[model samples]
Target: MGWMRRAKVARDDPDSTGATNTVNEHQINNEGQRSNINSLPNELLLLVFYDAIQSHDNCSAVLAVTCRRWRNIVIHEPKFWGSILLGSCHPLGKYRLWTMRIGTHSPPRRISLIIRGGPSVYIEPEWIQLFDALKARTYTIQSFHFHGNSESLSWANLRMGGFLCEEIYLHLDDRLSMNSSISAALSEPTWPTPYPPPLENSISPKILSFRQA
Candidate 1:
């Protein structure tokens, strides 16, 4: 995830030369000699990160760039990345790279790992591809939340599969028919979709919350 630093540098200084800021292994200890955060043990550091990033979709990337020590900690501990954001404005490559942190053999989640789509969601192929690439509940999600317009969901092609999910929550705008929206979301057995035909290998979830806001 050290690559995130380069990505940040490139984004902040897009027109400049392509060279990225090199990571300093001693940066944390050297730069913040008097900082309390610097004194916390590795166990405490994990607790701090979990609390700081539970609401963030890109916790791993954000924490990785803080320092080499923190980056190494996040890379080895996958649970820190359980909460992921969807339909984000970040480039598709970044999302694809993010998925590399999750795998089948990873640790069991005490609670559901969430994937949420914000109001900023674009609902295009890029968004669809992002969800499709998630694999499903077993290799990926356990809970889901989406907030966007109905027309946007018309383009969704999610294929739900893998392990059963605990919940599916959607908050959609009232511009289109509710049936259209739910059909799209319930299409795939594991992935998100608007209105695709029923398929095999699916599990029933607890609830589907559809609200107009």
Candidate 2:
């Protein structure tokens, strides 16, 4: 009877040891997983978040509200705030404000205005005002392109100070209709002429070209 009891006790001991070992292994795995998750560098994490936000439009506001860390990165990302694509229904004042914000925040290296929705959608007068402001700080702008109707060129008469623009591309919908007006505007010797005054000695004229298309 005593020998049987000893054998039974030994069996129970091995079973309890096996159960304890299994529990320990599971705990170790759980701890390792947590450590791995926390090991990612902050910059890598930020990049992951940025990739999520950049894949969509109109999600910037939501991205900004995600968290303090995300907000900091999103606000400072130059690509996030560089260009403002004006929509036909966008309010003139709102467009002006957004342009100013982008100029102040990131100061884009290029300004591209696409006016191709239709001829009826004219560049607003407030856009002219924004351009005037941008011209004053023209040292930051490297290239400017206008693709749309000639009616939008009316504001080109505004004078501009010293600017080192490498290129200026003007695409006129009706070149003949706007030729005389554009020529007159360009010829103006006034201080604030229609275009940012040519960056004479700053950039080579050879670097400049005009395309009618």
Alpha-carbon lDDT of model 2: 0.51
Model 2 agreement with the true structure over 1-213: per-residue lDDT tens digits: 654555556567876665555556766897898577447776776667557544533344455676676567666665665434343444345445445545555544455555555434434565545556666653455555556655454434233334445445566665554333332223322322233445465542122334344
| RMSD (Cα, Å) of model 1 | 10.6
True-vs-predicted CA distance for residue 110, candidate 1, Å: 12
lDDT of 1 at 3: 56
Candidate 2 wrong stretches, greater than 4 Å: 1-72, 79-82, 86-108, 116-125, 157-164, 175-213
For each candidate, the alpha-carbon lDDT, in order, equals 0.54, 0.51
Per-residue lDDT of candidate 1, residues 1-213 (tens digit): 555676577668857353443334345554677376768899999888888876665666788887888899887777776655544465456655555675534543222222344444545566555556654434524665555555443333233333245565656665455464443334433433453422355555433555555
CA RMSD, predictions in order: 10.6, 17.1
